[model samples]
Target: MRLCPAPGGPAPLVVINHGSPARAADRPGLRPAACDSEAVQWFAARGFAVALPLRRGYGASGGDWAEGFGRCPQADFARAGRESARDILAAIEAARRLPAVSGDRPVVVVGQSAGGWGSLALASLNPPGIAAIVNMAGGRGGWAEGAPNTNCRPDLLASAAGEYGRSARVPTLWLYTANDSFFAPAIAQALHAAYTAGGGVAEYRALPGFGEDGHRLFFGRGGSAIWGAELGPWLAARLGRPLASGAAR
Candidate 1:
């Protein structure tokens, strides 16, 4: 689904990728392709064309869940993430055809959770025209059955971050929360450290704790207020334009 303001001319594009469903059984409901309405409006109102793609194996675009990452104990986080990136890149290519989308303008990729991780992987490729990336609680592993913040292999996840960071050139903004059960501040910090140490240009912000799960921040009703302020300024600086004060609201 692609949403945009009334057409005038080509405008800056925002590729908004969604996260994967928690369970495989949920794929059937994906046919309609769920999205954060507030997020769509938030970016659309700000004079950007937003593209939301329902990747393969989900929604009507069913095929296979290319991003399975193996199973629990030995999950391949990196492989799964890169596979997701492949779909996102394909979406970018399709988005270029939207009449309201400007192919030459700065492209900003925003993703939540698994989607965010995919965005990070995409960064490693340094795709043409992508100006920056915003990762909202980006990570691969989370909530293992009864355990909280217990990923399959934390060390491997950090190493994967370093692996992506090594080839990433685009500046990235990562948002997380102190109380996130998925990737707590400590682990998030470790991953950030590894990524930066590997030469990735990334700015990480650990916001104050949100409700029960900060991982929901990007999709929650008031999520914009938390990420909007920081994002507007970053986009303005990156795209060499001034954004309206309350544009994100």
Candidate 2:
């Protein structure tokens, strides 16, 4: 776990989750985001202490990989997402115990790709202290045959999203790029429709394509400038404070 505290007194906590690699073999090499990473620094600059935790079976936290959703067509996306949420919850609980984190303030959860999927699952539980969520290109069963825009079972994925939405009351922001290779616009729209239809409170935004693949927009260089602009006002509204200027860099 990498905990980067903001300057001054205790601050609201923001737990940022990492995504699952397309290849299972890469899991073992995964590592927690560095304290200086753009995402972590972005939160720190905004007066939010950031915690980046490596889930079980990844990097140095190895044990057993519990988030597998079986094979392509038979994938149990909902179950896998719940498993990932369990770890995210654990990270939140642990971070809350730190003095650098303000216990009185609500937490913000941010995730990309599979981690974003986990955030949605976590929202379904409606865990206390989680004020909001930011999902960047979140989804599963993408690139079934190592091809862009190819999903294993989009219908099932949408169904699973509905299942999560039934109990997810916290407001959420879902951001996707037009050229996201993982979850294209059509799939993203379908997921959003199903989720909102099932009572989820989410605002979905489709941005213009970025770089070669929009799926990497959140982590790519200069990516924060784009997403941060949208997030600033949204987050300020929830936190009831204006964000400090020049924080996105």
lDDT per residue (tens digit) for residues 90-203 in model 2:
999999999999977999999999999999999999999898899989999888878888999999999999999999998899999999998999999999999999999999
Go through the candidates in order and give each one's C-alpha lDDT: 0.81, 0.90
How far does residue 93 in candidate 2 sit from its true spot (Å)? 0.2
Candidate 2 residue pairs that clash: none
Which pairs clash in model 1?
30-59, 31-59
lDDT of 1: 0.81
- The reply for model 1, stretches above 4 Å from the true place, is 5-9, 31-36, 245-249
Backbone clashes (count) for model 1: 2
Give the number of the best model, judged by TM-score: 2
TM-score of 1: 0.92
